[model samples]
Structures are given as structure tokens and as C-alpha cells.
Target chain A: MQKQENLSKNQKIILDLIEKSSGPLKAYSILFNVKKQGIKAPLQVYRALDKLIEIGKIHKIESRNAFVACKNSNCQVSKATAFSICENCEDVTEVSNLKLSKYLSNFADKSGMKYNKYNLEFFGLCKNCKK
Target chain B: MQKQENLSKNQKIILDLIEKSSGPLKAYSILFNVKKQGIKAPLQVYRALDKLIEIGKIHKIESRNAFVACKNSNCQVSKATAFSICENCEDVTEVSNLKLSKYLSNFADKSGMKYNKYNLEFFGLCKNCKK
Candidate 1:
């Protein structure tokens, strides 16, 4: 079983920043936070983000080239770590539900295809923004 | 409710190309297919993809800067159209379920956050690819 662990000081702030983010965060944003805490160099921030992700505590959002913490704390409940991002506010609100995920998985399994699986990212405004 | 309509003769080929694809497709790949049908200029295919997406007939996978058709025929059952895409083969499996989606939505709603929701796209090899 994968266990959740606290990130290092540098990693914590970066994680904390993303956890509080309204939208997906670019690598620069993470780097910015690191500089504020007396950490220097782009490498430091990237390394921290890389390590945190490897620990399974965070995920990289490929669409926006950003990152976010895994909202789910553990694997017991089997919650997905992916989400839907709003292009306007950059606020990520999980997703529109899991029905889409299961359907895709089943579809691929039936297709007899072998590939790397990625979460789908949709960019758009929320209901409020539409108004 | 939005209605599904067949694309124009030109758009049909583009849509067909994506629909029959086993994985997500990049814009260049779309352009590749477009050229095969005597169509030139990248704008033509992009316009077609844009229009298809607008009518809610097809979806753009932002993570890969690629595209795929909506597997769902209608919105009555209320399916989240995002997916889990494979990095290696570019094959997309729906997800590894709705629980993740519902949870994210509930978390956001509870957080008093108004955001443009996006499906979180993750990248990794499938079970077979791992072997």
C-alpha cells in the first residue's frame, strides 16, 4: 500500500501553495513560492515538485503544464487524482464525476490496446462564468 | 439540448480519423490526415476540430494538445467526458470511475470555489505496457 508522508520544508510550501490554488499552477508559480521562502534556483523547486510527485502526493497537469496535490489522501477508497481545470480562473474543480473515467477504461480494455493511461483535461468556464 | 449532426464532407474525414484512432491525436497528425484528402492549410482542420468541439460532438484532450470524439451519444445519463490517456500508445481509457469526479465536485462546492472544472489528465503506461 502507498503511504502518505509529509513533504520536506521546501516541498511543503510548494505543495501548500498548489493545494490552495484556485486553478492549475505552472512550474514558474511553484518556483516563485520557493524563492519567497529563501529557497533559490529553478532546480530546487523543480526537484521538490518532482520528488513530491514521485511520492504520489501530487500530480502534473499536462494540459496547462501545471501541477496539483492529490486531493485524495489514501488509496483505500480508490479515488482518482485527476481533475477538470477552468481556463478563466485557472481554478481546478475536480471534474464534472467518475462515470467518464470508468467508461474510458472499459472501452480501452475491450479494445485490446496497450498504452499509458492519462486523465482527460477539459478547459472552459464554469457555470457562473458562463453567466 | 445540444444535437449531434454529421460534419461537412471535409469535416467528416477529420472526425472519422479521430474516431477510428486508438489513441489521442496531435494537431499535426490531424493535419497529416487532412492532407491525404486533398485538403491543405492547417486552418481547415483546426476549424473543423473547433466547430466539432463547440457543438459538443467532439472533445479536445488538452493534456496532449490532441483530440478525440465524445464516446457518449447523449447527456441524459450525465457522463463526464474526460478520460485516462495512455502516454505510450496514446490510447485513452475513461478512468482507473465517477467517485473521483463526484468527490472533486463536492470538495470544490464545499470550498466555496467557483472554477472552470477540468478533468485531471494523468500520464502513465497501462498494465500491459508496464510489463
Candidate 2:
């Protein structure tokens, strides 16, 4: 992963916007939000997003087609990711449980497939949504 | 989940195509394949894909944005899904491990969040790819 200081101008601008967002932001919405900052064009947003995701500065919630900042300071690569999504409210929370990560990371099957990465998503109602 | 007999014409077409496929099929690719069969619009493809996924006849590989037929005969709902994806060869296999599925289904975190659905994907090189 490249250092944050090495980020290009557009990358920094896009990353900053995502980091400030309270929840995941879609590519179009990110492009819309940064339009005032001279970041025009959907391709530009996608390019920056690709780089941001590559650098582990942001992660895409594949189910939602949205991007969120990596809250784990220890995450240098976006290889292993798990998220809990509230079906009712569409709330997404990054799961950082050590045991769960370890279990998945060490998971092996009879297929003899050695895994290098994994992504898990859990869906249900959140605490607030349960009320 | 609906019975196989309840599937609409478009859904049956899409499901049959996916089931016959050995690999995952992307939305546009599915659209292109079914075009000759009288399904013209992209929305038609998407709608059928959505219903097929809902009924567990298909599962979308979120990482690849591709759809694969559910190989597990016992899986009547598209709730818990796990797959082994070969990074090098792009070979995707639906994982049907009873232990893994049970573990994930019973998984609970300290956040008091109860999950009703989950999707897990593992990425690695397949035996053929590794060779």
C-alpha cells in the first residue's frame, strides 16, 4: 500500500470525502459530492475509487455497490473484510472480531484450496432497528 | 422462496441458462445470451436475475458481479452462501460445507446483533491454476 502522503490530488480529495462520510457512499454519489471540488466525470471517480480500494484506504460494500473508509487502522490491505448490514435500515457496520477473522482466515476445506483472502457479509436488524 | 413451477417464463429461461453454465455469468452477458430468446431489455434480465436469486436458484458472486446457479439441492433459500473463488483462473465453486455453514449460522458477536443471512467468499488459486 502506498503512503497516504503519496496519494494524488484527486485520490486525496475522494478519500477525504469518503473518510468524512458517516456511511458507505456510492460511486455516483461520491462523484456528485466532489463535483464542486473540480472532480468531474464518473471515470475520474471510478479511477480514484479503484486506487483507494487497492490501497486499503477504503473498502467497497459489494452487496450495496457502496464505498466506505477503512476504519481499522491495522488494515493495510483490503484482503479480509466482514460487514454486518441491517436489512431494515440499511445500516452497515464493519465487523472487527478477532475470533471470527481467525476462524475464516484459517478455514480450509476438503478441496485443498488454500485461500489468501475472504469477504463475509451478515444481514439482519440492528439494535435500534429491532425496537 | 417460490417453487420451480411458479417461475415465470423469463425467470425459467434465465435460471436454465445459469444452471447449464459451468462458470458464473455476468448480468450483461446474461442479457446478451438471452437476447436471441426474445428478452430484449437489460431490465428484463435484471428482474429475472433478482427473482432467481430470491428463490435460491442463483447466487450473485458479489466480488465478480457474476451469477452462479445454486448447486446445493438442500438450499431452498438464498440466505447463507459460501464460495471458493480461484483468483488466478476465475473458477468459482459454491462451498457446501456443513460445518462451515453451521458455524456461520450460529455465529454471534458481542454487539448483540443476530444475523439471518450471510455470504462468505474465499479467494485463492485452484489446483489447476496453481499447477
Candidate 3:
């Protein structure tokens, strides 16, 4: 596991907002929420987001262009990620299945390419939404 | 297999541009390329992209915010997708491994949320980039 580093003021502020949210948060939305803290620019939010993502503090739901807090403390770096997204409710959950992560981490292709990172997203209806 | 539907003028023009490219194309880039062909607005390009994606004619590399032509004819819909992306050269290829696809397709999570779709992207150094 990578050692946790101290976050700057802006990163901490933005990350706190995302971490507090029930679902993923978008860049603009993050900026809007953090403006009271003087993080007014989109670039500030993006820089914070990029840093947070690099340190495995959060993962981006690429399909939705939003960010969610990383639930697994074992993931010190955001290299291999999998999420289960509810299509109806837009609820996003970080999947912590050992078998799935292991299978994907060890996966290789015939392209002769050395895979170092991967992201997988599964879409479905949540229990509540399915009811 | 789902029957192929006829593409409108805008759709055909945009699809042709994306197909002729070696790598995935972004929305703005697609709009720029098709401007001479009368696709002057961003909405036009997005509409065409949405339709192309719906029919499995193209798949979006969400991480990169680009679209690539689907090589597998068996994928009549954009429900399941997997891609191998070269981090160094940004080269992207659609992975057609049957076993991998089947494994992912049949994968059931403990969430009890029936997954109907998934997208996976593997990042690595391509053959040429490794040299």
C-alpha cells in the first residue's frame, strides 16, 4: 500500500465534498459546492480531482463523467477499478470483489501490450430501483 | 442479430469520418471534420454519435471522451464492450476475445443487481511503444 500523503487545502476541500455526497459528483458541481471555500475556478477543481484520482482517493465514473470516493483502503493507487452503477437511480458503488479484481489484474491479451491499469463499469438497476 | 438500419445523411457523414480515422475521434473533432459536409453544429454531431452508439456502430472510450468504430460485428448493440488502450501512443483497439467477453457477461455480483451492460478498458504500452 502506498503511504498516505497530506492533501493541500483545495484538494482537501474538494475531496471532502465528493466524499460527503451520496453519489458521484461532477467537476462543475464540485466547483459550485466549493466556491464558498474560495475554490472558484474549474481548473482548481480539476487539478484537485486529478491529484485525488492519482492518489487513489477517488475514482472517476467515466461514463457519467463524475467522481466517487474510493471505498477500498487496500487500493492505494487507482489502477484497477470496478464499479456497479444503477442505471435508474444513478447510484454508484465501488465493487470490492476479490475474485473479479484478481481475474482482471492478471488478465493479458494477445496484443503483446503490458497492461498496467484497467477500469470496468457494470450497469444495472439497483434493488430499490428494481422494486 | 439485430437488423442494420439505414443512416441519415448526418449520421453517414459522421460515421465515415470516424471510420477513416486510425484512432478514436472526439466529438468536437468529428464536428470539425464534418463541417464541410454540412454538420455545422455540435448537436448534429452528438445526435449522430448517440445513434451510432445505440446501434453498436461505434463505442465511446469514456476515459478519453472519444469514439471508435466497433470491429466486432457480433456486437449488434453497445451493451458489452472491452478495449485495449496504449498509454504511450494512445492507440486503442477493441478486444474481441470470446472467453473474456463471456466471462464478463456472465459475471454476477453479490449486489443482486442484474447487470445488463458493461464497459472495460485496459491501459498498457502497445507493441511499438514498447520498442
Candidate 4:
């Protein structure tokens, strides 16, 4: 994992906000939440987010255009990451199963193509949402 | 699979453009490509896209904010879908492996949450791009 000390001031601020959220946070929402901290522009937020993502401190939920802090300690080195998303509640849970990650890393297509990185998002009703 | 005859005019026009593409097509790109076919507004294209996605005629590449035609005959009924994306070339290929789909459909997390729908996007250099 990349050392936390390497994060810039803005990156740390944004990452902290994401880590505190119960669910994923969108860029605009994050910007709004951090405005008091002197993050006045969207580009500042985006640049910090891009850096955070590069260091594996945060991940973007592509489907929702939201960001979430990486939950797994081993996630920085893992080539595959998966998330279970509740469509109704908008809750996102990162899957950290070693076996699952191994299976996906070794998976090959008909053309025998192998992938170096993968993001899987599963959509369904959460336990509470199903009730 | 949803019958092709069930598609509305605008849906058909947008679907054809997506299907004919070598890679995924974004909503605005689809609208631009079909403007001569009478698709005048972004909402019209989005509405048709939502319907097409609902019926499984096309699948969205969440990371790229683009849509691609489902290449597998069995894809309409499958609960899980996976794509291998070439990061360098921006090429996307849908993975239609029965075994992979089955494995994911049955996958459970630590809380024993099983997903009804999943979309996996793998990123890597394609065979041609690697050379």
C-alpha cells in the first residue's frame, strides 16, 4: 500500500470525507462537503480524486459517478476488485474475498486474453431494502 | 431474448448504431450519429437507451459511460455479464462464458449476499496493442 504520508493536502481531505461516508459520494457532493476547507473549485477536487485513485486510496463507482474509500487492506496490490451495490438504497460494499480475486485474476476469455485490472459491480436489493 | 420486433423506431435506430460500431458508443455520440434518422434531442436517445438496456438488447459499460450490443445469444437471460476492455485501444469485448456467468451468479460475500445482476469490466492492453 502507498504510504498515507505521500498524499497531498487536498487528497487527504477528500479521502477523509469519502472514508467517513456510509455510501459512495459523488464529486460535486464531495466538493460541497469540503468547501469550508478551502477547496473552492471542481478542478481541485477532481485532481485530488485522480491522485487518490492512482494510489489506491479510493475507487470510483463508474456506474454512479461516485467515489468510495478502498475498504480492503490488500486492495492496493490486488488486480481485481468487486462491489455489491444495492440499487434501491444506493449502498456500496466492496468484496474482499481472496478466493474470488484469485479466480478472476486467472480467468481467460475464448481468445485467451488475460486482464491486468477489473472492476465488478453487482446490483441488487440489500437485506434491508428487500424487506 | 426480447424480440427485435418489439423495439420502437427510435430504439431501433439507436440500437443499430451501437451494434454497428466496433466499440461502445456514448449517449451523445449515439444521438449525433442518428441525428439524420430523426433523433433530434438527447432525451429521445436516453429514453430509447433506457428501454433497450431494460430489455437487454444492449449493455452499458459503466466505467466508460458507453453502451455496446450484447454479443452473446444467451446474454439476454443471463443474470451476470462481464467485459474485457482494452485500456490502450478503448476496445470492449463482452465475455459470454457460461461457466464464468454461473460462477458469478452463485457467488456470495462474507455476509452471504448473492447478487442478481453483475457487470464486470476488465482493463488491459489488447493483443494487438501489446505488440
Q: Model 4 over residues B65-109: C-alpha lDDT tens digits?
A: 999998886556435778899988899888878888888888887
Each candidate's DockQ score against the native complex?
A: 0.26, 0.80, 0.85, 0.69
For model 2, report DockQ: 0.80
lDDT of 2 at B109: 83
User: Which has the higher lDDT value, candidate number 1 or candidate number 3?
Assistant: 3
- What ordering of candidates by TM-score runs from best to worst? 3, 4, 2, 1
Identify the runs in model 3 with alpha carbons over 4 angstroms from their true place: A1-5, B1-4
- Interface RMSDs of the predictions, in order, are 5.6, 0.8, 0.7, 1.5
Report the TM-score of candidate 1, chain B only: 0.75
Clashing residue pairs in candidate 2 (N, C-alpha, C atoms within 3 angstroms): none
As for TM-score, the candidate ahead, 2 or 4, is 4
Q: C-alpha displacement of A63 in model 2, angstroms?
A: 0.6
Report the backbone clash tally of model 3. 0
Docking class of 1: acceptable
Cα displacement (angstroms), candidate 3, residue A55, comes to 0.6
Give the range of the ten consecutive residues with the poorest summed lDDT in model 4 chain A: A73-82
Q: List the residue pairs that clash in candidate 4.
A: none
Task: Candidate 4: give the TM-score of chain A.
Answer: 0.92
Candidate No. with top DockQ = 3
Span of ten consecutive residues with least summed lDDT in model 2 chain A? A1-10
| Model 2 TM-score on a 0 to 1 scale | 0.93
Cα displacement (angstroms), candidate 4, residue A3, comes to: 6.9
Model 1: per-residue Cα lDDT over A64-105, one tens digit each = 678876766552222244455555666665543455555434
Alpha-carbon shift of residue B23 in model 2 (angstroms): 0.5
How many Å off is the CA of B89 in candidate 4?
A: 0.7
Writing each residue's lDDT as its tens digit, candidate 2 over A23-122 gives 9899999999999999999999999999988888999899999999998888878999999998888878899999889989999998878899999999
Candidate 3 chain A, poorest ten consecutive residues by summed lDDT? A1-10
